[model samples]
Target: MNFLTLPERTSGRRTYGLTSVIDLGTPIRELENILSDYSHIIDIAKLGVGSAYVTPNIKKKIEVYKEYGVKPYLGGTLFEKCYYQNKIPEYRTYLQDLGIEWVEVSNGTLDIPLDERLTAISQLKRDFHVIAEVGSKDSDKEMPISEWKEEIKVLLEAGCEYVITEGRDSGSVGIYEKNGNIKSDLVHEVMKDVDEQKIIFEAPTPKQQMYFIKEMGPNVNLGNVKLNDVLVLEAQRCGLRSETFYLGERECRLLL
Candidate 1:
């Protein structure tokens, strides 16, 4: 358990290199166990799409996360669902009741107008800390890189706390191909125009995560991480695992 030699990591808070884990209705006992062991590394627990509405004791779930110092919020898809159903006002009021502060605004599934969606970002920012998602969820409906960059700029300017590069939980949409390969060219161009620190790359796969960690350093914000992979991610970030083991001291040795 001694990680004194490990690569340094910031405490789990609203900080850089943040790890956002998806709370997929894990049993309370199991959830407690995991949190007890790793909550320090977990920044946010996103109640997966529509889960906050259906999970038993949903409010208690949020309390459990907070008790462990892990912030919780509903997924962006759920926000889109409420917005499409004409219940955004009701939903927004209910968020405070649920004790979650991080709000996600996305148009990945619905046909929301670009101006209206970005305007919503501005409106929502007035009340909540928003994480705006930029990119279509449909793999076939790819947006041009130039347009994506502009959208991210507009969202950030609209008061979004961070821009989520839509790589859905499946790792098959948004910034990734259907096979989970990253579109490096598109990502590089977007990063050139946007602040790398303000981005939370949707990296569901190990390779995808490593790609960003290697490119942006270990603390680059990453999201849609499965609940169980929190520690594994810490390992990769510290080069304690194979994928990034070379990152540990290879350069130091080379310099020597």
Candidate 2:
């Protein structure tokens, strides 16, 4: 069972090289089946938006993720929903009761003031591992690279274990243009300015994932990856795919 030398990657509960999968509404049995085979590559399973609020057997689902060693957290949009309704205290209590260890602090949709967002990050850091999100979900609303860097810096300082660049599930906002093109210049600027290890770029599409992998190597943290694309993305990360063959350490004799 000889294997080709693939691109280097970290495994076993990694922090930097993460694949944060979005769970829209996968049934518990289906989730278990997928995790049974592919849990090794999955780092985080984010129950998208407010699905956690209405999901039946939600605790059992969280336990499934935990058993597989995948950190499960509610999406930032749910945080926004709670904040909008002025129920953040209730949200915290609910998360604690659910035994959820991770929290996402984001204000993508709501106009939560900057100071308040940072305060929330700081407060949540005491009881949970916070992953704050930067940038807006709105395609037309773009934050300048300078602002992005500053915001990322402060969020990390405020106690966020990681900061997600909002490329939304649609892959047509935040880091990506409305046409789903990566804002290459903006990406490069932020990469140069921020600590790349702490940034999770939300790359939902294959093309976007390819761009980040090419630019940031195999260890780039990516989020909003679809469930089915997990294996496909892992293949690309290891250079098993044609698009990323150049990333392999050992040259292929066929090409030579």
Candidate 3:
């Protein structure tokens, strides 16, 4: 560790300042390599969408995450797919069979109503640590802050352990614009009444990750992080990187 003083942060079982990475088709050997080296700062590992269906030895993959102290979860899209096809019950069995204890409940692209979604969380929370994702994934479906606030509160109340603001895999949609900039005003308005600790902002891009660290402090929950960038993001959180050097006690002045 560096000798310079950085912002105070919590380690292990993070509630507010947490990092969740997306395992989008990570091969088993590569997955082993990344988790072995970079799992210290990671809190959760999401098997993105149906990638788990095609990926070999998913049971083994989940075991890898557990061995590294990182909880594994199936993406909400998989849940949506199952529920849409009248197989939510089967989906539960599948996850249980694999011994996964974390599950994401989201309605990003589904036609399911808000009430049903909340009910699902209420029930799912009984068996797994629920990570509910709120917000539309449609790039054109812009939601007002008022709706975001109400929906987040309702989901949390329904027993979700955490709520993720959808940024999609591309970092374009929900909480972020197509150009990958955060909708800061919306976030401030929501955090005004909602607890920031229960919310995870999906920031797939470095700039977006840095913005959340600056805005919500180093411990703000961030998700959808790529495997290779785990340490880079951690460095930013501790002001070890140039973008957030101002966060440290040491003076950092940019020169032209």
Number of backbone-clashing residue pairs for each candidate, in the order shown: 1, 0, 1
Off by over 4 Å in 1: 1-6, 12-14, 248-256
Ranking by TM-score: 2, 3, 1
lDDT of 3 by residue, 140-200 (tens): 9988889899989988888888989999989999898888888989889989988899999
Best by TM-score: 2
Q: Write the per-residue lDDT of candidate 1 for residues 1-256, one digit (tens) a residue.
A: 7734555567636568899888778888889899999998888788887788888888878888999998788988899998888888899898988878889998899867779888777777788899988888898998999889998998888888888899888899988899999999999999997888889888977888899887877788999898899899988988778878766475446554
Using lDDT, give the best candidate's number: 2
Q: Which stretches of candidate 2 lie over 4 Å from their true place?
A: 250-256
Could you tell me the lDDT of residue 255 within candidate 2? 45
Locate the minimum summed-lDDT window of 10 residues in model 2.
Answer: 247-256
- lDDT rank, highest first? 2, 3, 1
TM-score of each: 0.93, 0.96, 0.95
Residue-level lDDT tens digits of model 2 in 1-256: 8566666789987988899999999999999999999999999989998889999999999999999999999999999999988898999999998989999999789867779998888788899999999999878786989988888888888878999999889999998989999999998888886789999999999999999998888889999999889999999998878888788554445444
Candidate 2 Cα lDDT to native: 0.90
